[model samples]
Target chain A: MNSAALPGFDDILAAAARIAPHAHATPVLRSRSIDAIAGCSLHFKAEPLQRAGAFKFRGACNAVWSLDAATAARGVVTHSSGNHGGALALAARTRSIPCHVVVPENAVAAKIAAIEAYGATVHRCAPTIAAREAACARVQVETGAELVHPYADPRVIAGQGTATLELLNVAGPLDAVVVPVGGGGLASGTAIAAHALAAECQVWGAEPSGAADTFESLRRGEHVTDFVPDTICDGLRGTLGAPGFALLRAHAVKVLTVDDADTVTAMRLLWQRMKLLVEPSSAIALAMVLGHRQRFAGKRVGVILSGGNVDLDALPW
Target chain B: MNSAALPGFDDILAAAARIAPHAHATPVLRSRSIDAIAGCSLHFKAEPLQRAGAFKFRGACNAVWSLDAATAARGVVTHSSGNHGGALALAARTRSIPCHVVVPENAVAAKIAAIEAYGATVHRCAPTIAAREAACARVQVETGAELVHPYADPRVIAGQGTATLELLNVAGPLDAVVVPVGGGGLASGTAIAAHALAAECQVWGAEPSGAADTFESLRRGEHVTDFVPDTICDGLRGTLGAPGFALLRAHAVKVLTVDDADTVTAMRLLWQRMKLLVEPSSAIALAMVLGHRQRFAGKRVGVILSGGNVDLDALPW
Candidate 1:
């Protein structure tokens, strides 16, 4: 499979099989109280309970295992100080492969500690995109390890799609599926899987209004990267990836933007009512569902709870 | 069949069969990261994710459904401002029967709202125990509803035991099972189930140091009820009921008491590491396991996460 090409249903299918032994088949949960509030039957794909505490494990596990023996022996590298970094490191450990993470110097201490805890070597660069990329490139050149771009890589996107594939299979049929859009990897993968398996299932992206690049890009018919994100959702701050954008565009996926305040409210609701400790990024999907009741009223909706990694001391509420 | 008698393994089996259709058979989850910290393989029976957000649902469901057609039609009543009231209300809703809760006026509005949301009529009384009991008795007389004691009744204890019964079935064999001793319903039931199913399996009760009634009772060879509770584990503050004390004493169950500080820390760890939003009461079991590593080291320990109903605004940490 080409690394730069957009991932399709076949790629997702292959990725699912590849990561089956490594990634968790997370449960699809429901909350009647939450369902009543949204006026829709909700099937929440609980990836918060996934290995490494997020759905990122699916893609990371896929990418790590998809490598050839010689390539895998060389190890894998990525530039992330969040769930993806932790996930990739944990995935590499399963295969006894070395993992390198080029993290920003200003990354959260806890997140960096988590990456290190997973037995990954963390190389800190200046807290700038260019410096981070240069450090990653340097690591790749020096270690001869394959670079796994968090969401931009075809394999990663395909891996992320497996979550939706499992969700669709477990949830039966759904009128629509709502997934939180970060760099659009999950959204893109979800679109591919839903389109192939449930043609009638409409795919929707829930984006934080503070970082609505995907929504803006779709509205303008092009990728946008000019805005700075100021939302409480730390994971959804990344600009839209090109492969993810292309796939989402091809599938005509709708984007729903939600306020961070509303995301916090939804997050609290999830915690208080459903007993789920989902992050703001994940809760944003539910926020979108509740915010737009008319679009999903009385319908069976599948919601992808993207992750559960949160700073206990720095809660938005 | 005798409400006053201590429930046996047979009663638990009956409860398991009775509540199978109404209650959730919650998953037994494992966290490798958490296991590494505790130096033991921990199988967490997640009752926090149970219907009505606690193991109380099992007992409540069993009691509500155990009623004959005429008795059930008359409705069921309980006096609680916590999980049991909500669980009983929800259980009654499943049978489409009227339910009444006698709650103190000083009870948390959120909890009262939850019980009401489950379609139970809330009967408010003064904050004193006598007043609450009087009010509950009045409701029993007025509505002709059967009284379902929170943890003392045989049917309730039998119902609570079903969680451990399911845990053993899913988790296979375990060296021991740790359960929080609130009113002792869950603890009593757990002891019966574990002793009957796996006679070699030891049963340990985790109680808050501030509310160490069960520990004191066991130490003194009699029930204790003189201490003023001061723990963050609100659910474990109740005086151990006579039936529960007798059952625990007969089973020779050991009780481990944990400080509120340690319980808060454990709760935070559960939320952060496992993505499980367990209350301090639920987390006490893990606290006991971690605190007494020597006892549980290298052993397979089953920890019942008693409940997940928590006040987000009033997080102990």
Candidate 2:
């Protein structure tokens, strides 16, 4: 074990308490059709219906709520392509504080509209990670707003863990829990909670094969900074942040990757069969279970459907 | 008041017992965002997630299950464009009996696929309602399968009523319940259930203005015929069946109409804000509530989302 002094189940519980008022305890759905296809009993924790359209809301709300009175008065700033910006904007609005979101110029119009709808000021940047970070920093300095990193903050990770807490509370004694890894906030939170509640339950992380940096990092016992991701699961494109990686590494979560084609197939299956309109990012986790069937057969498994912020016009068939 | 006897709450309770193993007790959803938009607290009774992808499953399941052993041995048949065919097919499959569905030649490929997937044989006919009924009669004559009218049968109406029974059991008392009207099975069933359990709670039916035959019939105090519908809500294009209309007449349910464009807009809004993937037919009820906002303002309302059997490739914008 690496034995890194990272936040544990206690921290996750505290985060849950902090975020209880702001976050929705999203439903856990079970489908016999899905279970029969996967050859396992599956519990789907639906966070797509969560506030601001994703589990990002849990973390964003927690991060925004944790700020001191003076710091909150100064406002909060972050950078995101879609869900996170909307989440932070809504969270800040709830606190009567200003929110400044640095968004990519090419971000979806609907997502940008949602951010603005929640009373956030948007600063458009070039469609690059570097440009987003630079724009966020500039806005923080110019507006005297405290920077709230999307996935790097400890409070955000704790808030994200609250979802798994609710899932386990409803699902009860699953053999494994799978979560999609974008920047690893959800994965880390889920791993910590699952480990605390049921030590025997294996905690696994699903990532897009097109964006398998977390998988590579877990395999190498260190962070991997080498690849550019080009997956349809746009939400999982970013590399895992340091705090998230540390918690995941300490918890020893197994990482599996699903290809983009399988992700689209999963999305269609969910919509057509399950009547759920989840996004490509959420489908990635289902794709992992389906593609890697031999490893999960006959097990009681739980999977987090991270969000449903899909643009119907741009759905990849 | 014409007191021509119709099935009541007791009949719906019997239907629930008969279809308990066959039909899903669908989920109920509450959303703060929807409440904010509609200026009322809203509870969505989600029948869209029912077996065979609609609330038709309840009626179909009850109709099939209510058949005598000799009649069941002969099997069953129905005529439908989509949902009822699939629902009957699945319900018959549960009894290990053959099912024949008379479908229009122009029926959508996805619906045809669903019918076939449920182990039913499809008999193709011309696109007209007369042609569909003629084809169904021919299939019954040839196969000796008993005709199970989709919405006209008393057993089917009784089964559909179970949805409201379950809704009231779960969501408690509400000021009103709104349901979509096609052949009037769901609306009549819901009205009967509400009258029996919560007499003070008003029951209303929503119809697309493009296919407002039911609305016109209610206004004229008689059945209307010889009207063609050109609405995008394919599932709600059916004219009111005799038994269904009789039940509605006995119950005196109010009917409201909304335009097709507003139905599409409501579908988009539900998808974007509530993360619910409902069909256009289902959205019509929501459109009525939104378009006639004064009728439901500050009230506790329940809306039945009848189905989610939509073609993702051809979603009407």
> Which candidate ranks first by DockQ, i.e. highest?
1
Error of 1 at A185 (Å): 1.1
Best by lDDT: 1
Q: What would the per-residue lDDT of candidate 1 be over residues B1-317, giving only the tens digit for each residue?
A: 97888889999999999999988989998998899999999999998889989999999999998999999999999999788999999999999999999998988899999999999999999987889899989988898999999998999999999999999999999999999988898999999999998899999999988888889999999788788888888788788999999999999999988988988889999998888889888999999998999999999999999999998888754
* Candidate 1: residue pairs that collide: none
Candidate 1: fnat, from 0 to 1? 0.81
List, residue by residue over B1-317, the lDDT tens digit for candidate 2: 11134667787898999999878889888877778889988899988789888999998998888888998988999998879999999999999999999999998988988899889998899998889889988988888898878777778888899999999999999999999999898898999899999889999999988889999998998899768998988888888977777877888889988899999888988887778789999988888899988999999999999999888778664
lDDT of 2 by residue, A123-147 (tens): 9999988999899888888888988
Global CA lDDT of candidate 1, please? Answer: 0.92
Q: After superposition, how far is residue A75 of candidate 1 from its true place, in Å?
A: 2.0
Classified by CAPRI criteria, candidate 2 counts as medium
Poorest 10 consecutive residues by lDDT, candidate 1 chain A = A308-317
